[model samples]
Target: MALRPNPTLRQRRLGSELRRMREQAGLGGSELARRLGIGPAQMTQMEQARIGVSPERLRMVASACGCSNEPLIDALARMTSERGKGWWEEYRGVLTVDFLEVAELEAHAERITFCTTAYIPGLLQTPAYASAVFARLFPPLPPREIETRTEFRIRRQELIRSGGTPLHTFIHEAALRMQFGGPSVLLDQLRALLDDSERPGISVRIVPFAVDTFPGAGENLTFANGPVAELDTVEVDVSQGALFLESPTDLANHRAIFSRLDATALAEKESRDFIRSIMKEVESSNA
Candidate 1:
């Protein structure tokens, strides 16, 4: 099979896990290749996600490498079986690869937890709010490009609306007051957020400014929980782009951060009331 020049994040993650399994078993690449009756180059390709691995082949690798993590193995096998292009594929070339990766992560996530300090979470933003955000890009994107990006972001919310995956989001008080598209837009966004919070599988919490201490140093983060804890991934939004974290250490640290945020955030009923208060403040200011 032809090696893939550009593998998706999921593919690369699978490859990385295979490599991890081998390393944990203290086996060298060549040695494993010999045991599997495959060439060293083939092993390299499989580990780099350039070539696909069948479920049967994956199990063979696990057996050969002495990996006893049954749940992880089963999840990896499921990933190997997944085929066909996702909805994000349509925007493959139009948007940056990071955008597609984010969607894919959310699509496969068993649960999602995210925190935003200055801006509303993308999955919860209203169309106008999203457009205003894109319009303020540093170099400034073309009007058409802004529309494209906004459309892409809105489409990402489909997973949330579908109720297929549960989402718990933490939004700092600053985000609710930013008024991205001015008071009118912010009001609509907050109202939409409240409505979304009432959804069956979605939970929204607000971290008030009154909190004595904040975690994550105000960084925007999205944690996508996988089928197995080891497969979980964290996406940190930075000015350069989204950075994905998957190492055991990174995952553990982020999980801790989220735990702290959860502790500091308001309860669901309180958060709803707080949003209502913010909406009133916006309405009063606009009037």
Candidate 2:
């Protein structure tokens, strides 16, 4: 079968790994190109994820770079070799590139931690809440578009629930209380959270509004762990743009914030009950 022209998330990730490895090895673009028998421009494009890498070429570059990390290399090889359409491919041209990028990241992440302020995190939202969210954001999206985005959000959550490992999420109280999608949607979303909380490998905690201060600065943050490859990435989402961090210092800072957030959050059981309380309030209002 002919390989697809557009790169999948896995392929793009491999490209990122190659570039990171080369940079860590202290080789400049020109120097790396000379060693790999490739032009510098090609090397740049490969590193930027503008092109898919070949397994043989990847190995050759790895060998030349003196990278003996077999597991990492093997993972990259497999990622590069993956040749199929991903579900998210259907959303191309319909959704923003940023949304697509996040979906790709979620697909590869074995573990995820996130903090939200304005709305429920996509992975944990119920379809109704998700719909309401989209309705509010676009206000004019056709029914079909609303449904598409909602489905996309739910599918992202499945990455954790249907997999060998479950995703972990920590939500701030402010986000949980704002009640997007109104009472009914919020009630359903809370119920879904409670249901998922009982599953193995999934941990949901609520950070209280009384935490005083946190390291997340002013926006939502996500930390993704690639368990097999032992890679950790921290993503900070701001109004301006999303920031990706891989440095130890950056990771440590995010870790500290997470730890504090986790510590101060309502206990697991209490958090569920807290959500139950909200559900009751919503139901009472509806009645």
Candidate 3:
């Protein structure tokens, strides 16, 4: 049989700590498990992150392994607690794991930045606009499924409201010009953008077509800032799929690109005026 790939982020973190504990004690998996009074397989599972390790179990294991690190145990406990069912759990059966992970990450992110080159980013999309986009991508989906996805999208947008830290979007001028649902729907969406742009926490910068080249112009990117002290993560959307990056070097690269994009984008007041210009054109077409 082919060997499976390495574990995920949360898994790898947990596994690394467990492996360190075993190494410190100079004990292999079976030896450590024997000392901990658990089956070797169980201990192996914990180290591989194939199974969830409770705070109590982790503490006991650490103790048996001759490791008494309170801070490490506490961190593992927090991870265990956070592994409980999240708001995205309901969509697990239907949505891909990749999509689910993104949703969960977004929920926990203290701040998010998105650069869109095509359609409006999900957090900024109107219901009508979202519906149109989803329909095109999921042509055979039933109306109910479409509604469910739309509702989820709307719920996701709640993260950007005044009640919470808002999502910052750097929208390209081309996205504002594209009428997804129709001219009327696009008009309403732009009007919503105008109103939302006034929000203090929410920053919307428009990258004009006339502006010189920038990194975001070629691709889309999402940055999910971790807890205050933790390093941030950057996800670059590619044609194949979304790539989650956590390396310090990659994160720094994306941060720099975002700064450059911000510099190239229109100033706040200018962006609002540009949005107004498009809104006016929408009105003219309607009239």
Candidate 4:
């Protein structure tokens, strides 16, 4: 009924799908609005996610648009009502919006493939490790700000362990030994990685120095597969903010990047052994 100032990423995605369906069906804005008994302005608002669309209305739209994929239609229906805000909503004004969107994507993603070269995967970082990583910001953040970010990151990890989404994370070996928060912190972080690697629906791989060469900085990203292939999203974090890529070309390119990284990475078992070896080295150094 009321307009939203900022729709969540999921809501925008639902809107995007409706637009895609209309386009794929070769329906025009005015014609679709005519068929659905809505004004072009309202159609624009609904398709832009500025206004909410009911599940009934969403189904009506899909039916009018000729999108017949049942599973996708069902997924789209679920997005129509994003009842109850997610945990990330708590930080709406407290943190940057882009980061919150990234978290929301992670939460609803059916499958996620993350490729990192410098930093440990956010979903896999320990509080201390995340704190240390967050501490290195260029302009620097206040202690309270850092604490907020650390908490947000820790919360993001819950989605992976929640038993539905599958995670395939590729980390550069250098990240395992970066000594963030000091030797003890990094040691604990690596041990945490070892523990997480063994979890169901979670796959952690390492791109070791032995790989020699692989994708460069441009490839560092998180590709979150929505309920369906067409809805997939790619997120790239930068110093200033995060970039959310949803165009078909962007998704395809990032998917290719992940495939290469996946191939370059050591097998899951070997990756754990690799992490264990690094942890032992850190442990021995402290002893």
Instruction: Choose the strongest candidate by TM-score.
Output: 1
How far in Å is the alpha carbon of 50 misplaced in model 2? 3.2
Candidate 1 lDDT for residue 228:
95
RMSD of 3: 5.3
In model 3, pairs of residues that clash are: none
Error at 30, model 4, angstroms: 2.1
Q: What is the lDDT of residue 127 in candidate 1?
A: 94
**What does candidate 2 score on TM?**
0.84
Q: Which stretches of candidate 1 lie over 4 Å from their true place?
A: none
Residue-level lDDT tens digits of model 3 in 42-78: 8777887777777788787778887766665676667
Q: Across residues 1-287, which tens digit of lDDT does each residue of candidate 4 receive?
A: 78888888888888888898899899998999999998999999988999998989989998998878988888888887679988898999999898789888888888998888887898889999999998988688999999999998888888887867899999988778798789998888888888999999989999988887878554468899987888889988776688788888888888888878877889999999998898888888889
lDDT of each: 0.94, 0.76, 0.78, 0.86
- Which residue runs does candidate 3 get wrong by more than 4 Å? 1-48, 53-77, 138-140, 228-230, 239-241
- For model 2, residues 115-155, the per-residue Cα lDDT tens digits are 77777677878888888887886348998989988888888
What ranges in model 4 sit over 4 Å off?
A: 280-287
TM-score, cand. 3 = 0.76
Clash number for candidate 4: 0
What does candidate 1 score on TM?
0.98
> Number of clashes in every candidate structure?
0, 0, 0, 0
Candidate 3: C-alpha lDDT: 0.78
